[model samples]
Target: MHDITHRNRAESPSSKTLFKATAIALVVGAGLLVTTVLPAEYGIDPTGVGGYLGLTQLNAIAPQETAEPVEDPMISDAQLASLLNPVWKSSAPLRNDTLTITLGPNEGAEIKAQMQEGDRFMFKWEAQGPVNFDMHGERPNAGDEFTSYWTGRNKTNANGAFQAPFEGVHGWYWHNGGAQPVTVTVTTTGFYEKLYKL
Candidate 1:
């Protein structure tokens, strides 16, 4: 009976040791599998957070501006004159068809004969004399003799003629109903006398 009891105790200890070794091996293998697979799928890691899933934090980029094309304005005196009127031929006696200067009193400038969208003309007076005129409801002041003139919206002694920026309608009326006969000269071409674009 004593020998049998001793043998039973030895066998019991061996069985318990084998069971513990098997349990420890299974736990270690499961931990290795979770560490390798869980980080790639759930973005979770034992050591780091974002680096586990290969993600990085960066700043947002802004959009850039695009380049566009521009078109130039059409400039042609003959074309402008034709746009104003085709049949209104320039008088051979008058040197300039853009404007006709009448040096006598109570005489109006015959601009209606050759007025056009691009027809820019000027009426410069040799002497400042009393002149009356109307343009788009804005008439020239009385007793103001102008030296050098343009048929544009703004008037000054800068240039001798009006400049047509583009194809647009414009008009001017003048009367030399003063005491002396006014001698006015005019010149017109395809040159733009003012800066319209900035």
Candidate 2:
């Protein structure tokens, strides 16, 4: 009688129901992967649901031919100090100045600081509109000889530290490339003699 009871339990309907439920779950999971997961994650929409939901844009691939990476070359405050020459010293008082320059469309202007070699300063400038700029230096009497430290295009703000590499003028040349006039406001603080327009 015990053997008969065990045989009957082994043949119960619960095992068949569990098998059917597992099979249904696997089919549903596979359907979701094809209709949703593949389209949203890989931008491959075979069922068209991802495109309708705008999920394809999340992982869309951009054209490689027109993509370019921009790099910022500004140096940090600590690096500016360490780059100064050991023999060069500044006894001048720390000065702060703010100047505004207006440029018409396609016009260019330069403002410089009279600095001796090894003088360090922090400078920040912003434009009312987009402008092109070159941060550079030149000797007092050097004929057409200049050194450019950094340059940027279509930028609205620039901030960085500068250590003079020579006894000369160090500053920026700004060019307004937009259709309207743009004003650039420059602020500087450091061991400089004076700030003047060039």
Candidate 3:
């Protein structure tokens, strides 16, 4: 209460006094920045005072980065190849093809690729809408005889790799049961003779 009476009557500091305090503060700050902060934080010692004060040793307590690989050690070419793609030997020539088909409501279509036995292939198919599909292969010289590998109902997409068991025409048969037309786009890359719509 007694100090509150002089709140409005307080004598403001003179410019000269303010300047002197600011100069002292600035000098102390610069000295600390050069001697303590730089050395302790970044191991950068401009003045030797920081090293003598053990502040520079504080920077060494932190971890140091290295160029060495942690998870990746020196590996053989076979190991590197397996890590990349792990290619399996196939007798069939490498062939890649993209096939697209549009099916109306209650309509079904078959897309097939001719491959020999033991021939491998990777296929991915995407449908604009839900569909029923059967991934199967037909045996050579067999009429209406087939082997079912995979089947799904109401699937939008599929990704798989197949090794022909006893190859003739291996492929997918997609049926659209929806009201609207669905466009199915399939991409295949592997050891197959050719891709065509049946």
Candidate 4:
């Protein structure tokens, strides 16, 4: 039988040597703290080397991220509101329509514009005499199912804007309520496909 002995011959480091190595490491850590960590994380570039190396930019960016941007005073309130609260955009072109309708006593008529969902329109109408009116919308092919926006009795005029909640025909139904006939003229400008008597 043969016996083999293997052992590590290197001596354990001396306390003096270990202390010297620890001091060297401490010096390097302090150097890095002054040159990099202080400027990059806290904007403290006492040695100016961190600023020269562009490490201060990191701390500069932190404040900018926490700060709210200053809004320009030249912007109008409406412009600012539009920026903060965006509006719907449609592919439809801008158009205008002026419709003059005459209704005999106790008679009714409708004038509407075909609008897709999110379309907007402005309308103004005046009647020679007071008439009852209803502003409503109808979805395509949805017979008898409609959304009424406004209604009034014996109104001589009306003016307002509308945003379509769904794809539909939207407009006014005015009924002559007086003993005599009434003539109503309606003007509309907006992003609608067509306007016609229905």
**Per-prediction TM-score:** 0.26, 0.56, 0.56, 0.58
Give the least accurate 10-residue stretch of model 1, judged by summed lDDT: 189-198
User: Which ten-residue region of model 2 has the weakest summed lDDT?
Assistant: 63-72
lDDT per residue, candidate 2, 1-198, as tens digits?
A: 366654866567697799999999999998888778888788888889888888788778674696455475687778787888445557867999999999999999999999988888999999999999999999999888999999999999999999999999999999998899999999999998899887
User: Could you tell me the lDDT of residue 175 within candidate 1?
Assistant: 64
Give candidate 4's whole-model lDDT. 0.91
lDDT of 4 by residue, 1-198 (tens): 533345343555778899999999999999999999999999999999999999999998744345665686488889888888876677999989998989998999999999999899999999999999999999999999888999999899999999899998999999997789899999999999988997
Instruction: Mark the regions of model 4 whose C-alpha exceeds 4 Å error after superposition.
Output: 1-88
Q: Please, what is the whole-model Cα lDDT of each candidate in the order they appear?
A: 0.44, 0.90, 0.92, 0.91
**Superposition TM-score, candidate 2 onto the true structure:** 0.56
lDDT tens digits, residue span 81-164, model 3: 878996567767899999999999999999999988988889999999999999999998899889999999999999989888
Ranking by lDDT: 3, 4, 2, 1
Each candidate: RMSD: 25.2, 16.4, 11.0, 19.7
Which digits, one per residue and each the tens of the lDDT, describe model 1 over residues 80-155? 8778885533322233433435547766663322233444455442224556644321123423442233343212
Error of 4 at 22 (Å): 82
